[model samples]
Target chain A: MFSAMIKKELLLVFRDKHALMALFVLPAVFILIMSVAMRDQFSSKNLEFSLFVKDLDKTSMSQEIIKLITNDKHLVQIKEKGDAQFFIVIPENYEQNSNEILKLNVQKSLKENEIEVFKSLLSEHILKARFHYISQSIELYSGKASKILANLEISSDKLYKVKYKNSKKLPNATQQSVPAWIVFGMFFIIIPMSTIYINERKQNTLMRLNSMNVSVFAMTFTKSIPYFLINQVQVWIMIGVGVFLVPLFDTPALAINGSVLAILEIATGLSLAAIGISTLIAVSASSSEQATTIGGILNLLLGAVGGVMVPKFIMPESMQTIAEYSPMAWGLDGFLDIFLSGANTQDVFIDFIKLFVFGLVCLGISMIILQIRIKKGL
Target chain B: MIKISNVTKTYGAKKALDNLSLEIKEGSIFGLLGVNGAGKTTLLSILNALVEMDSGEVEIFGHSLSKEKTKIKSLSSIIPQHLAFYENLSVGENLDFFAKIQKASQEDYDKAVSVNALKELMKQKASTLSGGQKRRLNIAIGLLNNPKVIYFDEPTVGIDPKSRNEILDSIKNYKNFGITVVYTSHYMNEIEKICDEVAIISEGKLVEQNTLENLFLSKDNKSVNIEVVYSNILKELNLKLLDETNIEVPKEQLCELLATLEEKNIMIKKIDYGSTNLEKYFLKRTGVEDV
Candidate 1:
């Protein structure tokens, strides 16, 4: 009996061309589009940075420092004040050894004749009495430092060393877009699956099945198997194609296999959810339109929240946390782990298990609700 | 054989089938007759174990409807009111698929002649098949299950006359093969023609049950006819005061009413007997004339 049900489901899925596009073509299209979009993000490129110097002391040393800072390819010196987005301020006593010199040490790096002129000018000041031994001592150190600096200083100074950090450029839209497309495909395929089941009830097909000695569980599970298999194969094909198109980090087989497994598992669970929802809707509806509308709302809500339309990464942290609660997010997360993270099957074991359990729970609820609804003649 | 006791089904405040008891014998074509919203389909659904009842004990072939649902499901087949095949699949594929669901092995196709013949038609897409052909497919699907009992809910609805006859014949054939048939329909003539016994349900209650012949013969209500220039008299007649079937009016009032009708420019073209057919009988039973 189970075999018969399986055969029936397979036939139904294969017969509809629209279902084929949704299950097979849609996922691959999404993978292609997203990968292409994100292609740039994964590339190896150095980030370009511009530096601006705001020198309070316009000394020859400051000029040398600016030349050195501009030497690195990654860092460019912006001469125009308005063009400079960031500035590094150099304090007047920045290089001073504070322990030895409590005063500003501008004289320590200046010429001997200039220091003597500075001392003679200070002696002739109106506040000569206030020039204590601390001031005289600073002048003596400045005169000695200037003579030493003339010998130690090189003709050209290398003041700053600019090293650029390695960065991977964001992939273009196609590569970045594929995963989201896969999610969309998953959602798109569900429409037919939901309608197929709901239409059965509307057209009295389920009632006919009920009369046929086929258990409800068998019917529901069997119907999902074909969809699961189709989605699994499509996910694998998409991943395989993606590996060739985008410079995927993971091997084709591992990536395709693990991601396929995750996708299939989630598809199965989601299909069960669809069946459960359809059964409940079909009871109240005398027409297929009602069922389709209700199913559409559910698929849309799940798809939107679960990252089919927008990737979860860009969403707020709180939204990402909420997305984890959605079934689609779990599926997408598992796939991404396998594809992008190069994770093995064991990594997705929990996700698959959760999805499987979700399927079972949905099916159980569907059966109970079906019983109640049918009894009430809704 | 199917048996139900104290079955009740309600939707909010509206009772669909209230304390209904019925027994459908094996190897007979039983017709369930009722007006729209009269609980015929509800009763069939319950019997098929497709839905549960509010309070009921149902037994099919000695298996409890609730506890032994799987067994019951295996024993029964249903031909629904609409086409049930996967329109995308060819006829043969559809049959093969349904047969597999019923656990009827393809290797044993030769053993089930009807199913094998149906399978041969699998090349044709279900949507491409004629209406009669689709109906036949529906019946053929039931045979795959090899059910002991089958329910046909308005099986010939919207079908051509020839197709209707063919479906009825097919149903009879099933009965001849000893499969219990529970046929539900609002069409009185079809029930009178095909069903050995008929049961009338009204407003969720089983109002009458007997052989088709006896149900029509045992009418106990006064039949009255009134002619008027305008059809508005029907709305004016307060039908609520009457009992289940008969209308009560004074003789002098009846005469005066006829005289008033004649005095007006109303021409009494003809006066015919009321409550003449199975439909009228149902209306009388339900206490609503506009069937």
Candidate 2:
């Protein structure tokens, strides 16, 4: 009986072209458009800050320091004055006098955060050059290179390294935009699901089913199965768009670095959670109009608060705290953990559990509402 | 067979079914007649176990409805007033889908299709079918379980005359297969034509219950309308006037009163006998003329 009900629901949904478009096409288009449109904001590798170098020392060591500064990925070299945001001055005999510190003069027009980043990058290179000069002097004076290196033993890895497992580079626009919009699209299943449910009630199909030996649980589950499957399909379609379609516009393709099974597991959990929420809205609302309206608005709000509209990293701390309570946030985080952070199944285990629990809770609430409505013959 | 006793259902402050009691024998066509808010729907819902009763004992096929809900549901099918099938699915798919839900065998599906004469339109979507064809499909779905009893709520509400007749014919044919049918409709003529027995409810209470023969045959329940040239004779005779010149007289009292009227030399232009209709009986029992 349950299978038959699900089949009927699937048939009805497949027959609705409008619902199909909303489920599959809308998210793909949005992801593609947003990824291409905001590609620069996501990829910061190409950004460069102008830096003027005044090499007064003119020694080989000073030239070496200049080479290090010019090799910086984020800084572009400027020869003349007044042509850069900041100027680096290597004072006379700066390399000979190892205790002397290089001066960095900046324009007042630079923003405070920009200035900080600029100063940090320049200071890192200068400190590396000084360490190199000291290592060379020690090798020269001791005349035993192996002993001097072993005693110093300093390396760049000691300065900064990730201790956790499965860490990767940050995501570009396509990776973040794909999953966020997919989550948004998955929750929008509520509109169509609620509309179908309300139509069943209005047309007396629910009463008919009741008279046909179908329990409320059976009906709700059967009705929810189709939308859950549709959500999974939506997820895959969006993933496909991110992998194949987004890169066509010259933006970097979304890469999934973690285990594929982990991503699929999270997708399943998120689908269940989304469909459960849709079922609740479908059964609880008074009319189709109210159901669709409330479902759409609730999904949009969840999308906003859950970091789908904007990255949680940029949101206010209080709002970020609130985002933790959203199931969408859990789902988006799980996807990002796999796509951006190279996390495996165990890495996102907590997110998957939270999503599954949230789905069960919503299903429980829907059942309670349905049972009460049936008892009261509403 | 179905029996309902002391069934009372209340919706907030309004009483939808007030101490209602009824019995329907097997293989009988029973008519439930009432106006819009006369609790016809509430009664049907309770009988089918779709709605709970605050106080009642309902037994279907000798099984308690409250305790054996699944059994009762399997034994009965309700054709709702509105279209209940998915419009997007074809007629065949709808029938097959409902048949599977009811656990009906392939033979049962074939039998339903043949009985309803829906063979050619099996591939047509329900939304594309005419009103009467859709009504037929609805009945076919109700018959999927091969239920012993069927509850029909306003089956032929808005349809062409030909389709209405076809549906009426189909309903009447249910008795040939020994299926008990509980039919409700606003069209009194349809009730008078198809029902073996009738029950009239008003204000959530049963106002009258009788077989068609007894309901119309009882002399006190029947009346004759007499039309005279003017109202002077009716005033002299102290007979209540139904209109300007028409007076409603008891069927049994008509002959003696007409003889006395002839003795009084009153001219009788026309004497119209009120037809035995469920409408008249409903009006007389409920004290409301519209329904």
Candidate 3:
């Protein structure tokens, strides 16, 4: 009976292309896309995109500014304005005319933050050129600029070193995105889980099973085992995408410095948590549409609050505190501990316990609701 | 044999089943007939253990329903009004899964499959099956373990006439195999066609329990049902409103009732004369006149 039930559940999920996409493909895509897109932010690198410079200023100062900004590793100073996401126009005689300001034209689609960072970098470089001329007490664009530049150390990037407690490896985009999305994807088991469960109830299959003497607990157990395994598979596949595919786009591949077993434990805990809540949702809802709606809203809210869409460090302090309360946060933190901090099973054991207990409580409540509904013949 | 003694169930202020007792003999197809909300489902649920009677003693095949629920459950299966098989699975897979749950032998479901004529659709996904085929699969599932008793909860509510007959024929066939069938439906025609004995419930109380033959034979042979349409002219006379916009009176009073209605400019709608089947008996017992 157990084997047949397990097989049936497995077939039910696998045969549903939509469920497979929700559980597997969507997360894999998110992991790849998010990791690549977040590369610059996590790596402390300048934004990478096309830039166009229209240097109308015929002065040496404008030439110097153009040289410095173009020298950035990620920015390419192109001549075509159409190709450039950011077009900078150095006003004519900017060094001679004190009233003139540099003008920058940007595409509407450019991310606001990246543009801000680029603007700051441009200002910083311009100021450094002005300070050099003032320190030398010479007129702007004097040939003496090269003489001073030869002796001065203009780069300050190395002065501030990013450290992660005692860890040597730098945390990168893949590290954050891989774990966060895996946790997010694992919870989507609710979608398919709620579907099958709601169908079972609406069809009176539950009553039929009861007549066959199959306990609800037995049914829930059989359902959980398959979904838990699916979650594990989902985690590994997304990790494979991060480890093997994300790097092809120049983003750093995911590095799992923690024990693989520990990661699996965290994933397992998350799977249980997801199943528990999904069961509750399924039991509470009257139809598949209702289950999907409730489950969808809940997953999105949880993901948003749990640092799945945005890293906790980026959130305000109060928001971070709230993130700590989301079960998804518990799972994400557990994975991050291993992925970024290289912690082992022992380090994430508490997180696992938190998730496990939450799952059990949900399952307990769900079972209670299910019992009430069954007795009430809902 | 099955016996329900003084079963009472309540939902808030509504009593769904009030001290209802019944006896269904072994190997007899007993039909529980009633109108909507007549506690037939409540009784079926009680028998299937899907519901708990507020107070009652139900014994099936000499097994106490409460004390030996698992034993009783193993002895019977229900064909619910709703389809219950897994639509994602093939018919064979669903059968195999339920068969496993019931600990049924290969020959058990093989016989069921053959009886239900599902051999060709074995590999077809259940969702793709037609309505009649779906109903057949439902019965085949209940027949998996060859339970001593089977409960049908309005299984043929909506379907083509051919499919309904096919379902009825299969349900009646289970009796030849010595399985006690307890069928419930509001459709009196179906009960008349297949049921040997019937228990009519109204407002959670049993109005009648006897063989279908005895149930009609024992009714007033001289009296029949007189139905009418209402008009303001006949509003002066007090009449029993068993159903909305309908009334029933004994056949002996048909002329007087018609005369008054005709004199009052009211028209006679239907007069069920010289017939005493489960429909009229059920209508008479439940205080409902066929519209």
Candidate 4:
């Protein structure tokens, strides 16, 4: 019996051309446009730093240092030495005289914090080279030098090391935009769901169903199942667009590194949350016009507050705190964990629970409201 | 069989159903007649268990509606005034859905479709059907459950004559099948034609309730109106002055009065006879002619 109800709902939804467009076509198009537009903001390939080098030592050691700096893919060597954000000069006799402390001159067009980072890297490389020179000279000078150097226990690992846990790179534009917009589009299901519910009430189908011994919960669940399936399909279509279609327009391809199970879990959670919210909107609205209006506005509000329209990291701190309360935020985070953060099922478990709980709460509230309306004959 | 007593429903300060009560017998076509906001729909809603009634006990088929709502609901079906089927779905799909909800078997579904003559439009979307076809489909859905009792709230409000007659005929056939039908309509002729028993409600009160034959018999006097070009000639006869040039006389006295008017050289332009109708009974009982 329940399956039949769900089948009826699916037929109604699939036959509605407007609903089909809202479910599949609009989200795909929005994902493609937004992901492509924001590609440069998150792609690492565009990162480059210009460095100007003035080597006066004329020694192989100073040349080797320059070679090391230029070898970095992110740093580009400039032929117009003076016209660079960073200028480095190696003093004469810096590498020839072992007792002479090296004096490296540096100049920059900007005094930003990033220049400090560059300076630190240069200093670390220079210090490593000096230590190596000292060790080699000592080895050549005396047999005891090897024993002394071994006792010193000089190791680069000990000198410079940093550790990170689950420190994958942040999500690129395409990766973040795809899931965020997918969630945004999925919640828009409220419009169609609410409209359908309103239509049923107007047509007396609900009253007829009530007369047939169908419970309010049964009707709501049956109506939501089809849309939930539609939402899941919507997630896959957006992901496909991000992975395959967006790259055709010269945008970075979204990489899906997480396990399929983790992605499916997140999608399920998101679908439930969207369906729950749509059910609430469906039962609460007095008419289809009101439902559609309220659903559209609410979808936009949730998208804005939940970091779908703007990245939460860039939002104001207070807004970010509030975004944590949004189901969309939880859903977007779960997707990001799998798509960009390389998280497994266990990694997104909290987000999954949150989304599912939110969905259940919404569904519960909708049922309660429906029950009250039924009892009151509203 | 359905029984409702002292059922009152209020919305804010307005009383939709005030101390309303009625009993419907099995295998009978009962007509509920009322004006708009006369609590006809509210009464139907309560009987169908769609709404709660305050200070009342309703029993359907010997089951308390409040205590055994599920049982009562299972036995009843509502064909509301509006088109309730999903427009996007085919007629077959709509019927199948209702049948599934009612837990009807395949055979029952086939019977319902065949009975309603909707087999030819099974594949057509409900939105594409003509008004008459849509009404048939609505009735077909109501019958999907093979319900013991059916409440049709203005089922034939807006339809062509052919469709209207077809629906009216189908409703009458329900009696032969021993299915209790509670029908409500604004059309007086429909009630007079289909209902074995009729009840008229006004201002949330039952003005009259009885068998159709008894109600018709209760009104003993039928009158005829005579319109004449000349005025005030009927003063000598036992007649009621309707206007300066028209007078209404009892049907039994009509021949004598017409002969008197002819003898008095009063040229009659038009003569009208009052027909025995539920409208007249309703107007007489409720003292409101608008309905």
Candidate 5:
């Protein structure tokens, strides 16, 4: 009986072209559009920023420091403070007074990621200037200190590595967009899922099944399995877009840095969560229009808060904390753990648990609601 | 067989079912006649255990309704007024799917299709079928469980007369399969033609319940028209004339009025009488003209 029911559900899902497009194609499109559009955002190597430097002393040392900051880099030295993202001031008699430190101020509205990049470059240049300053004084180059200063390779410093601690591979734009939008699209299962459920309820198919000894829980469970599988398929389709399609537009391909099992765990957990919410709304609302509007608005709100629309790393600390509470964020974080940090299933256990528990609660509530509605002959 | 005792349901301040009790015999086509919000649906829902009565005890086939819900579900099915099957599936698929829900054998699946004359339309989507065909499909799926009792709630409504006749015949045919049929409708002719027994409900209470023959017994109606010879005694008897030839008199008074006319030396030409003038009986029983 369950096999036949699952087959029926599969047939329904396969036959609904609009649902198929919403579930699969929409995420893949997002991955492609987002990855290609924001290609240069994640790669600091190609960033263009300008530095405003005021050499108060007009000395050779400050000149050398300014030259080092802009050497072979796109960080051009600008005379106008308004045109520069980084403002550097060499205080009076800085070469003479050891207490006078280089004062650097950044533009107020720069994104945190862009600020971190500028800070890394500035730190590297300052250290290199110290090396050149020490080399000029032969007395300071004595014993071990002389050897360490002389051997320093500050000129070619690998300043700010984007890779997480104890992990390999710098996550690029496609890597982030693919998983982020895949989670967003998976949550959209509420749309088609609620639609089918509400249709059944309104058409009295549920009443017929109830009369035939079919429990509401059984129907909900049967429905969840098929959509969960669809979500898995949708996940891979977006991955395929990230790996093959996005690169067609000249962006780097998505790198799978962890085991496939990690992806499966998060995908299944997130799918259940999506299905749970869908079923709840399906049985609760009086009409399909109500379900769609409520579900659509809910998904949009979750997407916004969960950092699917905006990366959490770029959000402020407080907003990121709020994002951690969203189920979509849990899904996104789980995928990022695998895709960006090469983390395995054990590493994503927290996210998986949160999603799994949330899903079970929603499904449990939906089952109760359905049973109540049926008992009331709604 | 189903029996109910003191079934009562209330929605807020309004009583939806007021101590309604009814017995539906096995292998009998029972019709429930009522106006809108007349508790027929509420009674049906209670029978199927789709609802819980505020106060009542119902037993079906000797099994307690509340305790043996699963048993009742397996033994009964309802053909809802709405199209119940998945519209996206083919007729064959719907039959197969519901049979699976019942865990019935392949024979049950084949029998449902054959019984409803759906064999030719098996490949067609339910949504593509005509109105009458869709009604037939509703019955076909309901029979998948081989239910001992089936309920039809206005199954022929909103269809052409030809299709309505087809559906009524289809429902009447269920009696051959020995499935108890509880049909609800507003059409007086439909219940009169098909039902073995009838129940009239008004405002959530049973106004009447009896065999169709008994409910429409001539002895109980005052509108049984008598066709008698042209006579001035009918005027003296204050008999109501349905036309010049027909005199509307109570069945009990018909003979008395005729004898009076004979005593008056009026020549008798013809007379006509039998049973039910069901529309009037229904209206008089329920005190409502609409049902």
Candidate 6:
């Protein structure tokens, strides 16, 4: 009998061409578009930063400062011998008139005032070079604003150095947002699945089926099958594409096996959630337009909360905690564990379990709602 | 045999069915007749176990529709007005799916309803079939389980005359053994032709139930209307006919009598007979005509 229901469901899935498009074909297309759109986001890129330094004093202190800045990560120093856009020179004497005048010049080329700060830092550094060019500024000098101002009028011999280590790593913003899109694509496909099934119920097809021997749960679950299959395929393709495309920026290919498993588990769980959501929409909506509107609003809400549109890392602490309840968040978290962290099955097992429970609860609620609707002739 | 005892269903302030009770004997073709809002479908839904009545128990072959719903399901089949099969599948596939639902085994399925019988046309999708063909397939699906009790709800609603007869013939031949048939329709002729007994419901209440011959006969069997050109002579003739024994003039004739007289040398333009079909019985009982 179960097999019979499944067979009938498959037959029905195939019968409606529009449903097929909404489920499988749309999900696949969505994953493709999203992966392409976000291709440069998560992938690592060969970074290059434009550096500008201004120095008035030609002291060894200024030269050493320039060397430290040049040695910084992926930075190229572009300083002029004269009044370059950024330049610094150390004075010969420091006792009389110890104050240094800082000038930030642009060849009508500089876009922002960071060059102004760059010139100020170099002038201060030349003042410090008049004394001992100390590397550890933290131990020798106080970083207090008042003390720095007082030191500006004192002899260069009292000048203490403030310097940073050359080695530093910076993450690309585009890379951080890329993975979110993959999950968003999954969410994008899922919303329609929810809406279409709701539409079916609004049209009284669900009641018509109930008038036959089909069970409420059977109808609800069968409606999810096409979506479930499509979502799984979508998860697979998006993960695969994400993996392949990430390497374009020299990032490691997203770990495949773990990511795939986690995605599959979350997809199953989310599919149940989708079923529940659709059932609620079907029952609660008095009109098809109302159902679509409510379903659309819900999709957007879930998508945003689930971190499909925002990176979970950057979300506020409370929002991050709240995201745990979102089906998309669970899926995205599972995906992150596998692709972002290279986790194994055991690593993602908890996320899978959480998602599974969420799916089951939602599905159960949906079935109950559907039963009421059926009995009530909705 | 099927027995419905004190079944009642209510929707808020409105009573969809009020203590509706009836018994349908085995091997008998029962016609359930009613107006649009007569609660006929609600009663059927209860018997089919598609819904639980507010208060009542329905027994089919000594099994309660609620407690022994599975058994009832296996024993009964329903042919709804709308087609419910997968239109994407071939005829054979559709049948196969329904057959599997009933747990019909390989040999029994072959003998009962051959899957291969639809083989020549197996490649064609069900959506491509005409309306009549689609209806036939729907009926075929119902027959797949070889149920003893079949419920046909407006089975002939939108079909052409030829296909209508074909379905009727199928229903006629459906009772080779002692299989019960519950046929519901608004068409009086269908009830008159195929039913052994008919039940009429009005406004959520059962107005009458018995063999069609008995109900029509006991109710005077003289429910007919005749229309004629409005003239003093024809109106007088109609008045004289109304005065005949074994006849009753409903309220409409009294209201039309005065206006019907002023004209002269009136010819009978047309004659219409609104004989007491089930709809009349419903109107008489419910006191509301639109429903």
lDDT of 1: 0.63
- What would the per-residue lDDT of candidate 4 be over residues B1-291, giving only the tens digit for each residue? 688888888877989988988888989999998888899998989888888887788888899988998888888888989988899898988988888777887886887788789999999989999999999999889887788999999999779998899889988988877899999998888888899998989878887789887775554436666788865656666568877787877767888887888788888998754333467667777777676
> Which scores greater on lDDT, model 2 or model 6?
2
Among incorrect, acceptable, medium and high, the docking class of model 6 is: acceptable
DockQ category of candidate 5: medium
Report the C-alpha lDDT of model 2 over B233-288, residue by residue, as the tens digit.
Answer: 56767787877787788877998979987888877878755343456767778888
Query: Evaluated with TM-score, which candidate comes out highest?
Result: 2
Model 1 ranges with Cα > 4 A deviation? A38-180, A246-342, A345-367, A374-378, B1-6, B23-25, B55-68, B105-120, B213-291
For B167-238, candidate 6 gives per-residue lDDT tens digits of 776677767646789998867767777888988787788777888767665544444444444443553445
Clashes of each: 36, 0, 0, 0, 0, 22
What TM-score would each prediction reach against the true structure? 0.65, 0.87, 0.78, 0.85, 0.84, 0.74
Q: Which candidate has the highest DockQ of all?
A: 5
Query: Every prediction's TM-score for the first chain?
Result: 0.60, 0.86, 0.72, 0.82, 0.80, 0.66
DockQ of each: 0.44, 0.66, 0.59, 0.70, 0.73, 0.27
In angstroms, the error of model 4 at A142 is 7.0
Q: Is candidate 1 or 5 superior in DockQ?
A: 5
Ranking by TM-score: 2, 4, 5, 3, 6, 1
> What is the iRMSD in Å for candidate 5?
0.8
* Tens-digit lDDT track of model 3 for A279-338: 899888989999999999999999999999888768999998999989999998888889
What shift in Å separates residue A223 of candidate 1 from its native position after superposition? 2.5
Quality of candidate 4's docking, in CAPRI categories? medium
Q: Give the runs in model 6 whose Cα sits over 4 Å from its true position.
A: A14-73, A77-179, A188-226, A245-291, B88-90, B105-123, B222-291
Over A271-335, each residue of candidate 2 has an lDDT whose tens digit, in order, gives: 88998899899899989899988988999899999989887777999998999999999999999
lDDT of 2 at A294: 90
TM-score of chain B of 6: 0.77
Local accuracy of candidate 3 as per-residue lDDT tens digits, B1-291 = 899999999999999999999999999999897778888888889899988889989999999998999899889988888899999899999999999888899899899999999999999999999999999899899999889999999988778999999888888888889999999886777888899988888889998888866765564544555566656544457865555445566656767877877777766677754333456666767787741
Model 5 Cα displacement at A146 (Å)?
7.0
Model 5 root-mean-square deviation: 5.4
